[model samples]
Target: MKRDQARRAYWSQNLRYLAGLLLVWFAVSFGAGILLVEELDQLRVFGFKLGFWFAQQGAIYAFVVLILVYVVLMNRLDRRYSRDEEDPA
Candidate 1:
């Protein structure tokens, strides 16, 4: 593939992954925590309110996981796209 085309493809992949992750983060943090707190509160985990826990701690953990996932994926993408340049004797 052409260099510009390859670069665009890589960027599109990266953006799509990032956007999906952010969407999940938003859904869990805001949607479940604030919008559906009452329903979530009906469920309990070890006596902790599900919605409150998500708002305070779960979202933070999810963000950390997202960072790790991005780092790993970027590393793989970099390796996959790296130029195989070698000197010809």
Candidate 2:
């Protein structure tokens, strides 16, 4: 493929990965933390209310995990598309 096309494809895939991951993070932080807090409150995680835990600690943990996941995904993507860097744009 041409350099321009490869560059576009690489960027497109990177954005797709980002969008999907962000959606998951939003669902966990916002959806579980606020929207579903009432329902989740009835449950418990190590004595703390599930919803409260999610609102406070869960979101932080999820964000960290998401960062790691993004790093791995980007590494794979970069390895696959790094050749684009060699081609003059």
- The global Cα lDDT (0 to 1) of model 1 is 0.79
Residue 62 in candidate 1 has what lDDT?
83
Consecutive 10-residue window with the lowest summed lDDT within model 1? 80-89
How many clashes (backbone N, Cα, C below 3 Å) per candidate? 0, 0
| Reference-based lDDT, residue 25, model 1 | 81
Give me the candidate number with maximum TM-score. Answer: 2
lDDT of 1 by residue, 1-89 (tens): 36666678778888988898889888888888788888888889987889888887887888889889889998988776565222122
Q: Distance from true position, residue 47, model 2, in Å?
A: 0.8
**Runs with alpha carbons beyond 4 Å of true place in candidate 2:** 84-89
lDDT of 2 by residue, 1-84 (tens): 587787899999999998999999999999999999999999998998999999989989999999999999999999878777
Model 1 alpha-carbon drift over 4 Å, by segment: 83-89
Give the per-residue Cα lDDT of candidate 2 at 30: 94
Taking every candidate in turn, the Cα RMSD to the unseen true structure, in Å, is: 3.3, 2.7
